[model samples]
Target: MTWLFNNPSEFAKEMISGFVSANASMVRQVSGGVVRNTASKPDTVAIVIGGGSGHYPAFAGLVGQGLAHGAAMGNLFASPSAQQICSVAKTVNQGAGVLLAFGNYAGDVLHFGLARERLISEGIPCELIAITDDISSASADEIHKRRGVAGDLVVFKTAAAAAEQGATLAEVLAVAQMANQRTRTIGVAFSGCTLPGADHPLFNVPQGRMEFGMGIHGEPGIRELAIPTADELAAMLVDKLLAELPAGISRAKGARAGAILNGLGSVKYEELFVVWHGVARRLQEHGITLVDSQVGEFVTSFDMAGLSLTLFWCNQQLEALWFAPAYSPAFKVGSVIKAPLLATEDIEAPAEESVAAATPESQAVAGQIVIMIERLAEAVIKNADELGRIDAIAGDGDHGIGMERGARAARDRAQRAFQQGAGAGTVLQHAADAWADQAGGTSGAIWGVILNTLGTAIGNQEKPTANAIAQAFSQASHGVMHFGKAKPGDKTLVDVLLPFSEELTLQIEQGHDLAAAWQLAARKAELCARATAQLVPKIGRARPLAARSLGSPDAGAVSLSLILNAVGETFPAVHPQGDTLCL
Candidate 1:
């Protein structure tokens, strides 16, 4: 039930059927399981691209006009056999010769290289261009030997463009090499992907942590770190790529490099834009002019919660060819724009505001609240795995990890603010900022908005009471729902929150005791959370899985209930005064 496939054979057959059916006009299924695009110009140089199937819009989907002439599709994460590669070469050949290009992976190299020998025996000329652009996967001494990631798109397109322009096979091979040499990519995975039909993931990543430089086929990454803000992650990726650029390019071109921000499947476009903003800022800081840029799911690892960054050091020839119009299922030219010009003053903006007129006592309380949030972060980390599992049942299986990781990061800043003795409002604001910076998803962003709103509502309030808390929650709930676009019955965290807020407001208006009011609200939240089982999800990743969730409560709602229960248990003096709390 955890996996989506009936078996490996079925998974592979379904993929092949869907690929050919969807792309029949562009590609034709040939003998020995090869798919050759019908539009490949006979007199033009031939470019053959292939790899495993799961990284769609990659090895196969990209085979079309101004791209690969043919693609050898393999089973999920498994390279195609030499016979399949040969079949594609024979089908696409038109006396122009073939240039074999693919990611620098062992199995692919073996199969493709063997196919090259077969093509030679049949009197067809062949050459190889292996893409090894992932800078994070290897040291400087080993980078050329590392596997390719998202940068393959750049390589395939650059070479294909040259071929389309009537260049001979050798010329196309040279351009492809130039593309690979100028390219570098780095990726981070928030969660591992499952191969089709497999119950368990091909690999495992602990909740709330990220693996940098993970391979497309579920290979382990070079490093594991606490995920940072979209901006921070973007900066980190860009910085590493910049450091690896050819020595003379930055000095000679002086900021004329190009960048591609690619999603490795399952990442939303909005999130990619946020990350791109960070990348643009970081590159600007280094005097590296982003000559051109692209954003989308170019290459993906079947539902992997990750992204990759590719940078290409471009000269006039490459830049001209890069912008030349071409179309494929995954890549498009002319959509890239020249990097924007930013001023030094904008880059060096002040980080702090003047608060000299504020009272010392208020500042001290603010600092204490910051410290409390940091202390609470440890609990978030401890519950990360359980939370991740909960999310997996009805969502992308990342909420638990995302919240835990983000909380832990925010806690670091909170602790520092507390040590400085900041006021409660100041502390809350700091935590909110840090949370957004550390967690780069919808839930984390929502949590940040809530904290920031709570800080504003609590400012200047002398005695915090149940009413004050209720008001703060109500304001926060409004902000979360507004940003997330979830209504109470949408099988979201709002399922628990909406009822809790309404009941708490009612109890406070009646002058009920704080504990008793909270107890009643908690009971209402529990019932609401359970009620989500009868509702279909209408938002986020859960919508597609909602039918299967007919008897299961939304993960977000369940987590909300757990959080409320935990709060009630941890603060017994504030616990409600009835057996209704047992819900």
Candidate 2:
């Protein structure tokens, strides 16, 4: 469905380069996303917004005078790495503060949350606000967990406007939160969206049918029904939104709101206008006044033939901000006078880091660690397609590709660390960083936590002992839980990881050799991972379509079990009956 591309792997990057080239007058390329070339007033809060790339104008296209100071773009449908987020923040931050904003997705939450902490630690005075505007993703009772949809524009606009008015960090955050609380969105799809080079779309709908409450990432819709005419569809959308108005609106009658009739992708402007005509009349019939309406592609899935409607319930402050002047590559309001382009300052490249020192014995075992990582790479590559198939059952279907890319990157980094005479722990730490950097998703962040925790446990100064290995496994389990916020039965990799860690720790405490203990633990992981096939997901993008994920093991759980089994096979010969590990 998405045929025009030179290489799928390079698509997201190349797209960013071209976008920057075309908008050079308005934006300047930064390490993570884009920033306005025009200078900001000193001591003004920086509004940095972003998400995955394919949703163009929603992010980078909105970076200009009266919008985001910068955008932290990520890989296609993947959240940007923490390093990338920090780079963009550092570039955009003036003397006042930095505000990080993005949609409420798992990967975005993890990476952006991490970057915020890091910035705060460095005394950058940063804050974060995740937009949760789509009412269909979560119920009113759990409204905090809703996924952000087209209403992202409303929140971004208000927050950026506050910043443009020289509002302090606290003031900017307050207005952004106000906008988020006031917005509601619902989307429907006639069909699914395809990723570049993918043979099929992310999910499919039956002919002559439409799906309701679909997400921007090609996640399956919450419900499906027979297709309706333009007027019928408009009524359905308005009724759904009106039925659940944000608190404080009291009632829809005589209420004023800013409307956004957003085309996901491949939905033409003419079709959007046709839909809007019916939508406008329906709102008027209800005695609701339209403050303003945005009709076109604002947020999108790659070529998805669908649209969403967003209503921002406005008070006097919100209405005035909505009408404020804005100039961006995608959206514009009142007249925006040209400002002198700021002189771009070159950022100094970070100096190469020196590897940590290791004891002679630990260094000798580094080669074995490299071999283990290579086995993981091989296993992931062999099963990548199947992993993707499993993920496609309920998710965006990129898990297999993400896993393969991460494993290979980890293996290569480990090999290089070993060649440099690094210790086992040092090699694993490098591998962990590479895996997280390359993968750039929820799974990638979890894997990075797992390996980094293990590496910390097995310090380079000493050879690893069975008890030390068991402790590292324990730490890894806790680290994954702490970072991923997934419980054992959440149908995530945590299901396999927790059981495996428990079994391994139990066996080692019973005085078993490391290899034999690991073998038993791997078996437990395999069983647990397989058991996930019967579970319904409680988290991530699959939560809404739990039925679709049924009968298919979670992709993360499967990949974890596979890598554990591979590592187990290599351990029997490498670590013998001794308490101390041997290569």
Candidate 3:
């Protein structure tokens, strides 16, 4: 477990500060991650790459002259906020455009997309590319759905090299996209990771067993298998990547490729080198020539004992770019001329946010909403460990942390808005944005959508009636489905939410008051959530790892039901049995 930390919430910030101080000669501190200590070519394209913080060298360590110009580092196992990305992009961008790239995860996609829009609106040109190179996440026919793993290094380097060559923004984008297309990677984990201040690891691998196709964020693998020897493991990885050669590579014979062997965390250099020896021999046996092969940890998952193999099926152009000189904190390709460091002046201040006052009736309602949110926060924090344990069964084990962090943020934001005399809708609106921005995952984004929808339905003029509340919940369900592309029976939170919405509406129609209706609907949601134990996931990170979760209820579904139950308890409703017919 990651035991050494003071005030876990400030871990990422402190890590960034220390990282900048250590590498001040190369990287400078910025709002999000780091930018080059030295200024870049005046009109050159800026390559900004980022993701969560745990992947050390991948993000901040790559910021330098010949590599990434900047990186937007997020909290541990979470994507950076749009505001963070925007700040990094603005600082690094000169007259030329910015190329924003990151791993292909839901939170990264959402935040990067929003940042791109904001930059464009501010008259700064921006481009985006979500690397999708993990062949295990999706089939070849749907490669776009794949996750970006260790192969991200290849794509980032290729793009950064092109930019260093003074390539136009469009040209840089083209080559980056090409690199992504030609790259394929697969990973296997022997165990899972432990975040700072956590007592136990996110997940565990049985002795003498390995989990194949594991994600970098402590997500359980697609399948678990008995451990194999180094050579056998190498062959398994090589054969898989070779099975689907990139287009234009007719066969392994007479083909040249770039190889990257990445140790996830606990896997040592000796272990990787052993695997690489077998990997090289296998390729040579197949008549494939290795070009500029790299063996080390490029991307990591904290202390997870895992390794990934990335094959960059290269042609003439890609091979040439692969050897480009680069200098950074962790990565170095070849020699490069050093440039003078920029002055360590202060960065720009973050934009200010404010809310306007609302009617007194709506303000009173906002106060109540704050109290309810406080209860939600307390409940989530108390049960965070249990939530994480459930999610580790199949999905990434950060659900507990994300939920706890998001609920606390929502509570704080709602309280601030209430103090500012905001209405109930505006209060929830603030909470929604804070949750999504603070928590940075599928759950965070979906919860944001849910609350925002309810905010829109419940206007600022008056207190919401039972009918209004029921309708708001119904609309919120639709919004969640639309935003997340999840449906009922998918073993996601949607399974609980949809039925809860329907029941709430039914209860109100049956003449039960808001207090009674909410409690009844919460019970229904709890039952629906428990029923998900019999279902297999049909989408999201858990889908590929479905078999491992057969007997476990969906973590998100359970959390949603818990939150509903907690909120329902905030109101008094005395109905032990069904009341006599009101009609």
lDDT of 2: 0.87
Report how far off residue 2 is in candidate 3 (Å): 4.9
Report the Cα lDDT for residue 205, model 2.
85
Q: 1-583 in candidate 1: lDDT tens per residue?
A: 1256666546766777777778665555554343443444558778888876778878777776667777876655555655567767777776789888888764566456656876898899999877888876567796555778788888888888888788988888889888888888888898877765557765677888898877665555678899899999998898777667664464623657788888887788999999999998888888777788888887888888889999988877777777776655556565422222223232222235322222465565555455446545655666777767766665556567567756876777666665565555656666775665445345555656667777767663343566887898899888667656678778888888878888888998898755678778988898888898899877654554567678877766766676565555433343344322111
Give, for candidate 2, the lowest lDDT window spanning 10 residues: 344-353
TM-score of each: 0.56, 0.94, 0.86
User: Candidate 2 residues 401-504, lDDT tens each?
Assistant: 99988899899988888888888898988888788777888987788778877887886878888788888988998877776678988999999998998999
Alpha-carbon lDDT, every model: 0.70, 0.87, 0.86
Choose 1 or 3, whichever is better by lDDT: 3
Better of 2 and 3 by TM-score: 2
What TM-score should be assigned to candidate 2? Answer: 0.94
Q: Which is the better candidate, 1 or 3, if ranked by TM-score? A: 3
For candidate 3, the per-residue lDDT at 528 reads 96
